[model samples]
Target: MADLFFESIEGVKKPYIDSLQRLLKQLRSPFAEGDDVGIKLHWGERGNRSFLPPDYAREIAAWLMDRGAKPFVFDTTVLYSGGRRTAQDSLNTAASHGYTAEFLECPVIIADGMDGKNVVSIPAGYKHFPTVQVCNIFEQAKGFVIFSHVKGHMVSLFGGAIKNLSMGFASRAQKQRMHSDYHPVLNKKKCTRCGLCVEICSTKAATISEPEYPKYDLKKCIGCAQCIAMCPEMALQIFWNSDMTVFQEKLVETAAAVWKKIQNKSVVINALLNITEECDCLPGKNHIIGRDLGFISGYHPVAVDEESLKKTGTDIFEKAHPGIPWQRQFTYAREIGF
Candidate 1:
């Protein structure tokens, strides 16, 4: 029900600040001064240096503070073990990025608490999940805002507020449930008797055939996609046709969940920048696939994501990866009337 506002900036210059200030004005309408605002975001990955710069986020924080709204920037721990593993560790990542005690007006808090444990469940309404484990901070905050760095992802293909809510705000168990759909099922015939996948799997989702290559149990898998990423024979593949639609539906349902939970209490804005080949959670820096588009803000998360995708040019990333499709999310969102 919110109009998505967009500003396409070629560079992160004065234009970025102007656009962000404009967005804050738009989002402040239904609320008043002295509200506690929670800004949910992905604080870049461990080694993945492609996330939104702290300087930009700092400006947004300043804008909220200027309006008398107390703001806290936050992100939860990762479902997989790596960077931002604990609340303390996450704090360090934020500090290292200049979102320090000395810089930003308020301290960053991990929404899901330490080790991703803080959560409040919202019952589903004919959706894929029975309930969603949203972190307590997001649930209890007087107001909420999502600051997503829109980019290509291996799972959902494209991620914005909708994807962020579905995956980003979830507890590890909820994340495990969201990611449960697209696991790699190894083919015995394609097995080259190589030991790479088994050795490289972070979750031990696969077991070596010993006489042949490794075979994935699928049951033990977390669908982290590492084995497929490390596959030499290209034997491991997520069940695109069968499971992708399910993944999309879950994303839509989770978006609806986020919308319902926050209702009039939340807004989302996406920064279409550093358009990398992989997620910001990637361990290494990647080349930007697209130009740095600007910022777009909206109360309707689905609409914002839809518009953000259009701004990225209508090319599906699957043509480049041939491994995923982004339309699944939009299609499902439309079907669910988001």
Candidate 2:
């Protein structure tokens, strides 16, 4: 079978749900009857407006059910303070976003458990990560559907299937590890002393006192970029502790490590609709950079992501997040045989 399949939402009234169904129909099921299939996705952060809707997820769950597989939607806890930092909070955020079990007809779960302690370290043998820790749900599901919303990111330049598989499946500690390469660099000229960065900082690395600009404690920072991403005045930027490409490599290493375990029984899907200037992890409205092209599905995360960038064009992400060595992700993936 071919490795890639695309279903365009253009020229259709019900583009999202209908086109996704067509794309799913073109792929062969990798699961046996009665298998537990996990549908991995990001159901938008608390106030995020650009995440893919639950209607599409419902379609995927229904498709899995029709094929005799029990499907459940899931996402892991994140490293930063937000709606998804803790498992219970993440589930509540998911439910608030209309991704409840009752609506999707399957349980919506947090893969890393309520306390974010359900994790397993897998051998990577890569240059960056000798071992990668991720959610301990690999043993629970016989098959997986990595449904990602392709969009621009502050660090990766673009978020797609590879990111969905990597950070999406990573443990909070692993997420912190991957994010440790950079810290927030404030631009005081643009800062409003709004204290948003301080408020959004998960580790209290960002602090502000009355009549003082925000101060970041590098020692306490986890490099999660929550402050950088949520800064209302665009005052914070990424300051790399090491070479910038190292961050990209770490991102690939984590994804590659997880992929090694799930590749055979998983499918990758990247939705090109709602292509935004920033990732759905951030709250508020993000600028749309592309028209609703459609959904691209494949057997490999790397391939699906590459095709998605090709369809959306790398120039779009580059313009949104300039000077990021995002190409290193692909090169590093190949270097490590990911």
Q: Which numbered prediction scores highest in TM-score against the true structure?
A: 2
Pairs that collide in candidate 2 are none
Worst 10 residues of 2 by lDDT: 234-243
Each prediction's TM-score versus the true structure: 0.78, 0.83
In candidate 2, what are the lDDT values of residues 135-254, reduced to their tens digit? 999889998999999999988999998899899998866776677645778888989999978877879999999899999999998766667645656577544345668889999999
Cα error, candidate 1, residue 294 (Å):
1.0
User: All predictions: root-mean-square deviation over Cα?
Assistant: 7.2, 6.5
